[model samples]
Target chain A: MNRLRFAPIPAGLPATVPFTGPETLERRRGAPFRARLGANENGFGPSPKAVEAMARASADVWKYGDPDSHDLREALAAHHVISPANIMLGEGIDGLLGLLVRLVMAPGETVVTSEGAYPTFNYHVAGFDGRLHKVPYRDDAEDLEALIAAGHETGARLIYFANPDNPMGSWLTGERIEAALSHLPDGALLILDEAYAEFAPEAAIPRIDPEDDRVIRFRTFSKAYGMAGARIGYAIGPAELIAGFDRIRNHFGINRTAQIGALAALQDQEWLERTRLKVGKTRDRIAAIAASNGLRALPSATNFVAVDCGQGGDFARRVLAQLAAQGIFARMPGVPPMDRCIRISCGPDHELDAFAEALPVALAGARED
Target chain B: MNRLRFAPIPAGLPATVPFTGPETLERRRGAPFRARLGANENGFGPSPKAVEAMARASADVWKYGDPDSHDLREALAAHHVISPANIMLGEGIDGLLGLLVRLVMAPGETVVTSEGAYPTFNYHVAGFDGRLHKVPYRDDAEDLEALIAAGHETGARLIYFANPDNPMGSWLTGERIEAALSHLPDGALLILDEAYAEFAPEAAIPRIDPEDDRVIRFRTFSKAYGMAGARIGYAIGPAELIAGFDRIRNHFGINRTAQIGALAALQDQEWLERTRLKVGKTRDRIAAIAASNGLRALPSATNFVAVDCGQGGDFARRVLAQLAAQGIFARMPGVPPMDRCIRISCGPDHELDAFAEALPVALAGARED
Candidate 1:
């Protein structure tokens, strides 16, 4: 019984879990959902001055946080004008994409992304054994010139991409991600993510050159600073790739009440423009509840929407198993023609009136199976 | 300017930080230190029901936390009677020692540890290029048979130790770490680090076999459950090495108000036995203010003490720079005769009366240099 060995890339990995938490499907449906609207979080919360600075930093949680998250990286380098050595803060954006795939991918290198993007950055490029490369999603976003020609045909030292996209809440604009930075690939690096850069459309946020060592970006007090369970996030690059994430991070891996609740949710950018007008009117009431259940919704800039579900992916997995048999958690897109779409998220209108009363009885129980 | 490359073990490491925190020396001493007692944190706080469950989970910080921190790992597996599949939790114990040195360190493997004990586990075994070794401190504790004879003379593969030790808060008897696990090294493993297992000494806690795949332990809601800025911790072991930390943790890196303030600071074990009788009366008032400044103190079971300062390590680095020129933040020990001591920590008598009124003016300004 002498097992305990492991390190051949986590013994050829496989424990996986890049997203499942709806409290493990309400502890396997012992109740509790009635529409949480799957993980793209920001359930319309966070900046009541970042929940009063995380209840005044929870009685100073016995102190250790400032592992140089120095006043939240000097208030995120004066709110992104940059240069707190181009900010780093972590433990989110899925721990800064597993420290930017352990500081630039090395094990069997190459990375790219897109095909059903952000499976936690392909579970941190297969927990660092790297060599990923997908790049499909062309019409429904994230296909920046086929991920810069699959990072110039796989010389890929990391690419990723995201920008207002996630399970089909497509986008692009910031001058087409600054004109796909002259088709990247000469020493790769891109990443970008922008975890729904505050529900997009500030011209979809491009203006790069934070010392552009090709791109890094990230961003995320978990979507529109609603503080996704306050894990914190940040990246913005090039101060030598954000000081090469202090040569391997976890320096007090964040969380002092999520660095004073993400510095009172970045000094309340007026509660992030009132959570971007409540996620643009809950993304137009989830596209008028997917056009009263006939479905179609898709054109989102973020805060989650998707919809489609007219057919395929086995009728959107039987309309997400009849919206989890009416309790409703909702999620979709795991490849295949974008899993005929479902997604959801933009919460709070009584959880979008319990997802508009569980979407026409989950589309007539997925059209009577 | 092409430089964003890295990954050859973070480009041969170096941008280090294995502890420099006291808010970067109070922002390079522009003040603010009247005794924070360096990084052995827990200034005796935390469970007012985990600061009322982190101010009632700060308005449910928009979901995301339960990335399966499933009710604080089923209340730390019923407070360690074990088997929540032998637990894991993380983002602290310096991020589960950088995901247990990236799931058992491969590149040039090796490991061991002790010399300067926890420099964040030798900055994650030199950020995963591993090959560490160290093995020194014997009388000041942690030598565990020269770290199991340097893990059977460098066949190493992770060793680490730490029981009630750190710097020089010496300890040993959990039946001398369960009789030094029959001199380990079979497949190696060990790790241990019971982050001051609640100010140690329940016979220095050592009844192993939680399916001992040789060992694992860890612990910490940041020491004596005070919650070190709520980074959380955990570990335990065996269930297939605690499910090889989901093959590479950061599963939404826990922090829903630190998993509801560490499950209300682990169901308040009477405020962790009243923070171990206020860190055993502030470790006997820091060994009676290091014997009224003549200086000696050492023998501690955690919550910090050290002291020593009779000589060398340049008179304990001139009495830790005259206790940081009077603001008194205090900390020492980095190899050598445990750097002729200095440490301190156990606080709350008005921060140890500002470290007993700046220790005889920092030992008369380090005996006039």
Candidate 2:
């Protein structure tokens, strides 16, 4: 039998996933997690309007979604006060990141990011056979200076920076990001992932020009709008760069129900604000729970809080495992310093109560270990 | 502003989409299509069970879909009497095709396909900088022998062939495809797009070994399953090849509602059989309508009927425009010889009635042109 010939890049890569889903873990553990807090999904749920829209659209799934995503794009453009041409909707931030990497980073070209930034972004870079230059996080936040330096040193084509950082839930002021933009390497494009933008303080939201060629900002319904399963996100960039996505993107890839749901979600700012309040309260509840358990919760602007176990990475791992064994699903950062914390997403009160109940037992188990 | 540096492949490509969706056309025309038939979507709709499942799943869209798509894959595997490892689900066939091209076709590598075959597949090839070797259709059907011959000549890495061919609604017997398998070029893999397979005659549905290394069969919920808007599809191939998708695919790309909806759709085979019966009736109704309008409807093993306008490509195009002007959405083949016909999808009786009402007027208008 002839060997199945794969392109050199994929063939050389390992068959690995960025993250193992909680569902897979549940199957393995032979029980479901009582409190689903892993993956940073917005457990406050999508807008009631969005859910209604999706449900209503369910029967209409016979028709293909508009390949142009015209209405949704128009609404998003209006919401962002940008031209429709400046926005490109995709399956998710993950899908759009893949396209962005493919468009700019040729094989062996370099990209720079903090060591423990988004693994999915790293996965896309590897998938495209792009070399990654990593910089360590500074004070548990993505170090913009270090990243820019690495980009300059490596002559990288792209630099990825996520604000309201995952795993640690640390953030920088928008002014800081705006100031750092001018320091970007000459040829490198900055990929600003604002997946948690809705949860951040207004001061943390950058005010970059939509036509800015140096950066492309990605936002998702998955995090704040609570539509992760809908698989929809959009990137705001220069018109030309946005148009470039059409050259390679799957034109009709967006799900019809998702498009409708997202559009409705965008229109319901009241629901979004309500969700923010719920998330804010949940964040506090989580922090209080951590305090009770003798662990410190890092200040968080996003829906998830990274609670410092006050121990090293190994201790945090043990705590996370114990939490899982106690029917609580949570994740910790993979790299050092950040891995001293286990990330927990804000959910409804009952789920938080479950987490509150589970943390002490988990910490005790980890201490015993 | 430094010009955005795109990788060589995309930089050289035109910003063109595979198809201008019906919605885009409606926007341009300042009117909605009375009958949405142009995209070959299932107008009969998904199973009620599937619709209910999707609607119920809407509230849970706050969580990311199981990246593994375990339950759906398991059901599909059981239904096909194959191992789950043989199946890989994607956003849609379009998304999977893009991944497949990226996985195998290196820059400037050759791929073979029928000239006017699924344009999305060709779009992906061009996106990846793969050279496409086109073979002309034989009697309005994809020339399998010629495609294999071109593959051999070009030492192509992939050959894309669709069963129950689109645009012309032509198909070859499964036995013929089984015979052609042995004739594939040494290194080329066959991309057997069975998107229309459920609507095809039983004899046209190929029964190739699931472990056949040379062929990967793509099936979609978009067509007969009535879930085009849901964006779910699957590919059946050798286990190793199926596993290769994990190396690059967006793990959480599938919509949560779509996964649940598709699983339910798969379970409701009775609904699918009923849809097939309805499509058969609709095909005959379209043919009868064509006959009344003094046109010939080609024999179709799929949901849509290709009605020869008894004119050339230009005249057929004019007729299509006239139908569109009358708020009827229909499409014709893009290439010559086959372009003498306009394709109409199987829709509800009222939609077919709208088409029947518009056809004679369209024919007269085209004659005047």
Candidate 3:
């Protein structure tokens, strides 16, 4: 029963992570899942140029990546038409959220997020001993207005909003976010999690304003750019707020391959466009498959689609387990109403073929159960 | 100035990073360094197998790395002959230090380390608003006894000691470390940073017992493994102490390429041993070069040699700047006494030749200054 002395918050906390990765599950199942679609990772892959760049960079992996991430940050700034000072590159969006939470959330400070939104953000809030206030999703979308209201109600220091959100694949318009910015209370920072922004529609992505102090936007190479394994992401906000990350961030955290790979990915806008189109098609295919099975697939602006199983949480859980039993990996929202639907990520035609073949079988099993 | 609310510590803190990277200096100077030897990176380079492994992993970058880091951790466990439960992987030693500091040192709590020893560790403690008490290096080596005594005096939560220390390239015997562990008072953890352990002599590396609760050991691929840019490191300690990291660490922090690269690197111990021998020879060459110039090279059990300019900090600073002016990027320690010596990493013959060509001229320039 010997234990090392740790901060009270971390000491008392459970060692539960937000998601048990597919690899962990595969080990438990004693077999690899046929489709690597869970976790919302893109299956179409990154730009050939990025893979080439990473392979080229491997020879120089003996040197530490530039700590300032100077070149990558500069490229991101130009790509987004903002000053480099307004950007801070981090390990990933998950890692950046951890830093953002740490920067503003002192012990007992309130942080507001949608109840079933990104759980990693909640993990970080609790890591820093911040009090969490969750506003439930409204009609399957992260209700931005409700999130703002909850932030105000709790006197929260930070509000988490993901445009084209996870699990549900719902989105809010840029106008909705821009108009809502007016009431961002003093002393509160809105963390706009735009990890999947590229897959989201143009209307869902608000204009960039580096001078905007009330909100910070996070974007990653993980989704539409198809570089989730690279672990590269950046935050754009007011220069002062971005500068605050320099106080606590792991300056050398970005991998050398990630830097070069991400830079190449940014340079390949054509590839990004093509991937977006492919994701759109695959998302449609998934919805069609769900419809054929007598399920309703929700509209999606992300690379994933949520299909209502025409059942409650219990039946949805059984369907999900059946999908796993059929060697198809998929996920669902953890909490109530959202859990009544099964989530599937957009994948290549072959993987989608596997899902297509497995869906009816999994559904039949769920119905039998 | 317009600003968002930040935690008290980060709010009051200067937006300073531990190391202003060599690339930042190059940008300011409008040139790249002729000799890439300042950051203690193994310019000897990663194994071709590792490079091949990373290049191979590039196409798979669409998948998030296993959050559990299952295969790599298992390989590392077998490599170190320890149970996997006793290990936790991270971005690097720098990132792990941040997590460790967050886990143990709440605001105002004390942590101890040698002055001018691994500023990044100090940076993490400061980021967490922990009070830091530093004991001056005894004989240009981290004074283990003084550090342990200082822990008692300050009631510090953690004590940091680097084997084959950075900036100065000195080490303490494992027997010395084992003897000191007896007095590591309850509630205090000793962070035994052996980042350069692979390059150190056999006697210097202590046998690790994962059941030991008094200390945690950190190792990185950035040192002798020659994968500095890959950003993979791991901590080993009692299962309980290691589990604490799961509560705060970025679960998916380890990059996919880094995992595969490190695993490939571990499987190629021949490459590691070859790098170690090359480093030893390079260290000898660097020492020989210093001796030929009438300077003294400090005893080293590392990939780098710290050469005394036979003067004070001011003279060494001049030598460092002169090297910079000559496009030779060398670094000196930050505090006095240790500051009298300049550090040079072991690189290829050509880079050391550039250093050889520049050292005497730089020394002459320093003498004149």
lDDT of each: 0.83, 0.92, 0.90
TM value for model 3: 0.99
Q: Which is the winner by lDDT between candidate 1 and candidate 2?
A: 2
Candidate 2 Cα misplacement greater than 4 A, ranges: A1-3, B1-3
- Residue-wise C-alpha lDDT for candidate 2, range B12-81, written one tens digit per residue: 8987788999999999999998998888999999999999999999999999999999999999999999
**TM-score to native of every candidate shown:** 0.35, 0.99, 0.99
| Predicted structure 1: clash tally | 0
Instruction: Name the fnat for model 1.
Output: 0.84
Q: Which lDDT tens digits does candidate 2 get at residues A1-369?
A: 364778888888889899999999999999999999988888889999999999999999999998899999999999999899999999999999999999988899999999988999999999999998999999999999889989889999999999888878889999999999999988999999999999999999999998999999999999989999999999999998999999989889999999999999999999999999999989998989999888889999899999999989999999999999999999989999899999999988888988988889889899999
Query: What DockQ would you assign to candidate 2?
Result: 0.80
Tens digit of lDDT per residue, candidate 3, span B122-196?
999988889989999989999999998998888888899999788798999998888889888676889999999
Say which prediction, candidate 1 or candidate 3, comes out ahead on TM-score: 3
Q: For candidate 3, what is the lDDT? A: 0.90
Instruction: Find the candidate with the highest lDDT and give its number.
Output: 2
lDDT of 1 by residue, B112-193 (tens): 8888888888887888888887878877787888888878988887788888888888878889789889878787888888
Give the true-contact fraction for every prediction, in order: 0.84, 0.85, 0.83
The runs of at least 3 residues in candidate 3 whose Cα sits more than 4 Å from the true structure, single-residue gaps closed, are A1-3, B1-3
